[model samples]
Target: MDFTPGPQGQFPGAEAAPRSAPPNFIPEAPQMESRTFGAPGRPGVPVSPQFGFVRPGQIRRCIHRYTFIWLVNGNSFWFYPTFVGNQFVQGFRWRRNRWEFERINLRRILFFRCF
Candidate 1:
């Protein structure tokens, strides 16, 4: 029993019909001019100067064997141990060129471990 339709059995009037253009058509590419925010002709909004804290030859020291240092907020530094299949023990924060000991909150730390 063949269930396939023959030539006249498909979409009754769509055979070899002419296709219309797509619903949306653009004749030419839109023009876009590159301009800076505070340029001469553009509105001058006071843009805050962007700068980085770590200088070219800045020296960073990691206190512990399994710890690493990260520059925070481009000013202060944060030192934390690399998690190795266990809960984090302790961390440190360096601010104003001084190292300060920071205790890890066990509750928040455990929450992340469970999830």
Candidate 2:
């Protein structure tokens, strides 16, 4: 009546040796998207042939949020750089406010650069 395998019970096709967890391996939670294309190198460095399924403007907003999260919490939900979420949107807005203040001081610089 017992279902537990015993020392002599053979499990067909089972490995002979009891499996050991890999030293450097960690189990990852299941995710919605299995893959993503992302910008290379560092932020603000500008990537050519920009990657991701989202639009460029939206990508910028998401990237801005991702960097803010990394700076504030040392972690981010930006597992895939292209995917945007509610939290990322909020973070982006917070960052955008600070960026707005900084931009105000550089209005002349921006004007000159554009011209």
Candidate 3:
């Protein structure tokens, strides 16, 4: 038996469901500039690498989670999932050289400019 629900089954008292736009409804456009930081041939900055990864001064979202992360200089910043509205209130940073992970509070960071 098919487990899928029909339109009326999903939403009661609603009319026939509206058709969805085509998957490629919006045309693709070429990127005007590189997303990587610094000029080409730089030591730290390199051209765009594979997905799900990034270099220094670059940010990327996790493939399977709502978390976002970035690396600047030698420090790494992470924004974990939070229920406190749309803002990220909890996270931690890893200091590459110091080998320490510090908790981050977005409220304090925004108010005091701590990070």
Compare the candidates by TM-score and give the number of the best one. Answer: 1
Q: Please write out the lDDT profile of model 3 over residues 6-106, one tens digit for every residue.
A: 66553211232113211222222212335644432343343333321222112212211223333323332333221122212322222332212233323
State every prediction's TM-score relative to the real structure. Answer: 0.22, 0.17, 0.21
RMSD of each: 30.2, 21.7, 18.6
Q: In candidate 1, what are the lDDT values of residues 14-99, reduced to their tens digit?
A: 23311222113222211223432443322432222231122212111221322222222122223332212122233343344444
lDDT of each residue in 7-101, candidate 2, tens digit only: 67532212232122112222232232444333232223212232222233433443322221222112222111222332221111113122211
**lDDT scores of the candidates, listed in order:** 0.27, 0.24, 0.27
Question: Where does model 1 exceed 4 Å of error?
Answer: 1-76, 80-88, 106-115
In model 3, the worst 10-residue window by lDDT is 106-115
Q: Which residue pairs clash within candidate 1?
A: none
Q: Using TM-score as the measure, name the better of candidate 1 and candidate 2.
A: 1
Off by over 4 Å in 3: 1-44, 51-70, 81-115
Instruction: Summing lDDT over every window of 10 consecutive residues in candidate 1, give the lowest-scoring window.
Output: 106-115
